[model samples]
Target chain A: MSGILHIAGLGPGDDALVTPEVTEALAQATDVIGYIPYVARVAPRDGLTLHPSDNRVELDRATHALQLAQAGARVVVVSSGDPGVFAMASAVFEAVEREPAFESVDIRVLPGITAMLAAAARLGAPLGHDFCAINLSDNLKPWAMVEHRLRMAARADFAMAFYNPRSKSRPHQFAEALDILRAECGPDRLITFARAVTTPEEAFNTVTLGEATPEMADMRTVVIVGNSATRRVGRYVYTPRSAV
Target chain B: MSGILHIAGLGPGDDALVTPEVTEALAQATDVIGYIPYVARVAPRDGLTLHPSDNRVELDRATHALQLAQAGARVVVVSSGDPGVFAMASAVFEAVEREPAFESVDIRVLPGITAMLAAAARLGAPLGHDFCAINLSDNLKPWAMVEHRLRMAARADFAMAFYNPRSKSRPHQFAEALDILRAECGPDRLITFARAVTTPEEAFNTVTLGEATPEMADMRTVVIVGNSATRRVGRYVYTPRSAV
Candidate 1:
């Protein structure tokens, strides 16, 4: 029996934002794996198995998907955003690297609307120019490296989108990150905090770095900091294509 | 008469990658405006007027869309990828800033699978970690700024994605960019070229910096350069979630 694995992104929270490709993939899938909330997004159906796990067990979950696929079960490892962007695709690939047995299993990644892009869309193209996406969580990387990246991105004058900006595990680091950004980019830089974008609870707040507070961001919020050229026109914020 | 404007993404060239949000917006549109190829992607109907324009005229196209909307035409401005990413969203907002009459047009940008994310999905998550997206076309920005961004992105150790990596107007600049990248990122760095992603002419190639050539990329290609921790697993390439 032959089986294939698809690392698919369901896109932010809205079903409307999810792609037809992912919808099709979900339709054909015999097994779906993801975090608890993401797994809940899929309707329960016959002949399908849903394996929902905790967030931090990405490696174990990836290994499980690979194992299921190796056992001739069609598997889909679902992620909320684009799977390749700090999501399940890397974990699955890393799992393949660690276990030689999973190497031969067929795997493909399907992209979706990542959180930053969804947030950017809501915030009126704050990332319209050259930009960087950084995950602010220190779970996998060091805080110092995060600080270094923040400084370099600011110095380069690139618009920035930050994911996983603040969480219960490390609330204070976001405060430090805000301080670093303020020091590097100055008080006049525009920063936007978008929480639960596209969902019922969606909210957006744009302010200068001087007015931005660490309390504005949480795990659900995606933060975007504009470059020197970015500004507001009426209610919209955007960065011009040309450099300042 | 109430009119709304949705600057929407078509998601590369594949219909399957297009989001339902954009699809619904198109269904409700009285006028659809975009570049020639992107506008062609929308299906024509009795009530909808398709307005396709040539390249290098983003501002004019944007202004037209706003004018249509201001005249009580529900308009959707289509872009190949996420409209917020180096596409029509910024142009529309800039138009609003230039003309006060266009400012009150209710505008929404719908996100899609951007080329870099789509390319990363095909290449097995090379942008799995923190990454930056840079448009290499010098039509809108200075070459010096592009070069500076490349160096800063390299120094920050961020994985990089280049859109419009090469064009007939600036064929030689990509070669210069490759040289700068080689100098900053070293010859052993991994680079992947993905052409017309998610479309019929889709092609993928991965090579090291030492082996890469400027001729490898074109206007149709999205190029991704992995960070230090990126490597190949079996036939797939991926960047580990953990930093090196």
Candidate 2:
């Protein structure tokens, strides 16, 4: 029997948001692998085995999924958001590159509703204009690079979305990010902090760059900074389609 | 009877990619309003009325939807991709801002698998790292601003996604944009043109910056330019998650 490896996105912690393509992949998988919380999102079945690992072990997890697929096990690697966006898809490809034998494995990346878009939907189109999505973790890239991108994005007048904005390990960096934004985007720019979007724990807050504090964001939060044209319309905040 | 408005995404033209949330919204919609093609995607039913309008009339269509909703009609405004991403969600809010009487209208924006994300999935994660999405259409924004954002995005080394890269009215501008991209991103950079993604007529081509021409893209295409680290892994193109 030929085995397949599918890197699937569970889509911001909502069952309704998960695409039928991904749901169909999960139903057909013999083994499901992912970070603990994501893997736990999958229901246990008679023939399916779940392999949940700790965070930051993405490479190892990808390798294991590849090995399982090589052994004729239909494997699915899951990520919280779209696997292609700061998630499992690239890691799987990196593994395939490291081991050329895995290159021939049937791999497909399934897209889903990413956090930034989900947050934007809830906040009334804060990213409705030109935008950029930056992963602010600083684990993979330097803090300097993030700051540089932030400044460039501001100068370009693009609305921005930040993933992994603040964590216990990197407490001070988000503050630094906020400082950079205040300097570049100025005090009046609107910013939205959407925590645990689309789930029961979902919370949304929109504030100005001057009013925003780093503590408002956590690891679960996705922060959006609007372009110069973004503003409040009734209870919602949105950037106009036209630019100045 | 209270009225409601839902701005929903149809997910890059695939039945399977459309989320259950969006499907449920369609089922309950008393009227569906959008550009011709998008409105045609919704099936005809006894209670549902489809209002198809021509392109470049976003504001007019949005106001009509608001009017219908205010008249106690459940309206769903459809966009081909996520409504919040260069689509109808912001247009709807812009209408709301213009008329304060519509403030009481209940509005919700449902997310969908946007063209860029769907294209990235098919291309094996070209946007696996930091990225920006720009609408190259000069209809709303000035060409100089588009050029400036291209330079800034290239300088920041973010993977880039272009929406409405070329249209019959503005043919030469995309060539100029490509010229700027080549100058900023270098000749060796990789670019992918994904036409009609997730649809039956889907076509994907990955070429170097030197080889890409303006004709590779049209209104239906979503263009992706990879970061410096992006390279070929087997038949796929992907950017590694890590930065230098």
Interface RMSD of 1: 0.8
Model 1 chain A: lowest-lDDT 10 consecutive positions: A235-244
Question: Each candidate's root-mean-square deviation in Å?
Answer: 0.9, 0.8
Cα lDDT of model 1 by residue, A134-215, tens digit: 9999999999999999999998899999999999889899999999999999999999999998899999999999999999
Model 1 clashing residue pairs (backbone):
none
Q: Model 1 in CAPRI terms: which quality?
A: high
For candidate 1, give the lDDT.
0.93
Give all candidates' CA lDDT scores.
0.93, 0.95
Please give me the DockQ of candidate 1 compared with the native complex. Answer: 0.90
DockQ score of each predicted structure, in the order shown: 0.90, 0.93
lDDT tens readout by residue for model 1, B125-189: 89999999999998888999999999999999999999999998888999999999999989999
Residue A86's lDDT within candidate 1 is 85
Q: Write the per-residue lDDT of candidate 2 for residues A140-206, one digit (tens) a residue.
A: 9999999999999999999999999999998999999999999998999999999999999999999
**Once superposed on the true structure, which residue ranges of model 1 sit more than 4 Å away at CA?**
none
- For each candidate, give its TM-score against the true structure: 0.99, 0.99
Query: Candidate 2: which stretches are off by over 4 Å?
Result: none
